[model samples]
Target: MSYIRGYDPETLRELVDARECKDRLDEIGEQRSLPALLERVWLLKVLGRLEDALVISEQSVRVARMAGTRKDLLRARILHASVEQQRGAFAVAEQELTTCAAEAEGKGWSGIAAFALQHRGKVFYDAGDYDAARADFKQALFLRQDSGVPDAQLESTLHAIEAADQRRMRASVAS
Candidate 1:
């Protein structure tokens, strides 16, 4: 299946008001489709409705599994991990993303694996584990390059790796 475009939760959050985004997501989520549900899950996460987002994220995973599309399943799993990360359950989020990354790797889905690693890197980043985050982001960048992902997508990970490196250096100096 072709990737559905323009459903990035962070982008949407910045583009629209929370209430308006929620209303639109609610309408779209009525279908319970993978993309719609996942988008809603992300928006709710941004809105700080962790419990609701978790429920929907879990549902998206289940639905995506039933749908049997590797990309969708991976994306749903990644989003679930992201919600956990947002809830400050960094360990759980890392574990979830680790599993997803392993599964994607096993399936030879490099893009999915890269995406999972990128999110796992984010989990580590949020926990102030800059070294680990840098490692993950570096690996993710390699994977994205191997998989021929867009340069636009790769740039953020590069920036993140640099930022992680800077943070690590600063922390070491401070200590």
Candidate 2:
């Protein structure tokens, strides 16, 4: 039931078993610890439980605002924004990421700022704004590099930029 206790962060991200995460959530019952709630929100999102994920994300943000650190609140907002993005609420996701980016920048948390920018790029990508997405993705990659974040951490952003470039090229060709 508490199988999540055994999985390291890298393993949780790369090798999450949604069934196991779900089982753990069910067994953990009503006492949703912050970490557990965040993990469950992620797993629910991955499992296409969008409605459930959105509910948990909102709860996480609300709880984090009152009882968690700044970093925790930022992460909660990121999770909420990601779920909103998946739910086709691009504007909401963009707004959340914009707030996150500004907060992280003000706090000098370049890595988190980069992450928020990357997610904002994703919002643009979802909205078919390939040019804007590529711009944000490129800026995020630069910020991550400047922050000395690991290359692995920036890989997805690089890929997003590449995808946006390709899409833009195709659009130019078609027109």
Candidate 3:
């Protein structure tokens, strides 16, 4: 069954229809066309349908693995972690991100490592562990900077740091 769900990206639509995505996944057989299937997964993610994304991502990972594309498999795993993070599955998200991070570090994929750090920091931020969040964000900032990430990402990460600090301040005030 192909995993081609009827996905409307508008948040208002919010119709991920995991069944549809799952059905469409079977469309991509062992023909060696990964990018197209990856597109469908990306669309599901853009539409805020995280569970669907995870499902499709898993399928893509399997395809990549069977196709001998280890990098793409790792990408799928990292993206799955992102979905978990969004769903507040913090520990699970950390496990995914940590493994990806380690792989990135070992493979010298600085860009991937930086992205993992940023996403992990977000998980920490949502968990209200400001200290851990700050550390993660700072590490991300440094990694991105060292990796020559674009200025836009740098600015956004800086804003995230500020936001994390403000949240910590609010918590202190409340306490």
Q: Which candidate wins on lDDT?
A: 1
Give the range where candidate 1 is weakest over 10 consecutive residues by summed lDDT.
Answer: 6-15
Backbone clashes in each candidate structure, one number apiece? Answer: 0, 0, 12
Each candidate's TM vs. the true structure?
0.83, 0.83, 0.75
lDDT of 3 by residue, 67-103 (tens): 8465777777777777777777999998888888788
In TM-score terms, candidate 1 sits at 0.83
Error of 1 at 49 (Å): 2.5
- The predicted structure with the larger lDDT, 2 or 3, is 2
Better of 1 and 3 by TM-score: 1
What lDDT does the true structure give each of the candidates? 0.82, 0.80, 0.72
lDDT, candidate 2, 42-102, per-residue tens: 7787767899999998999989999999999998898899889989999999999999999
Please report how far candidate 3 places residue 94 from its true position, in Å.
0.8
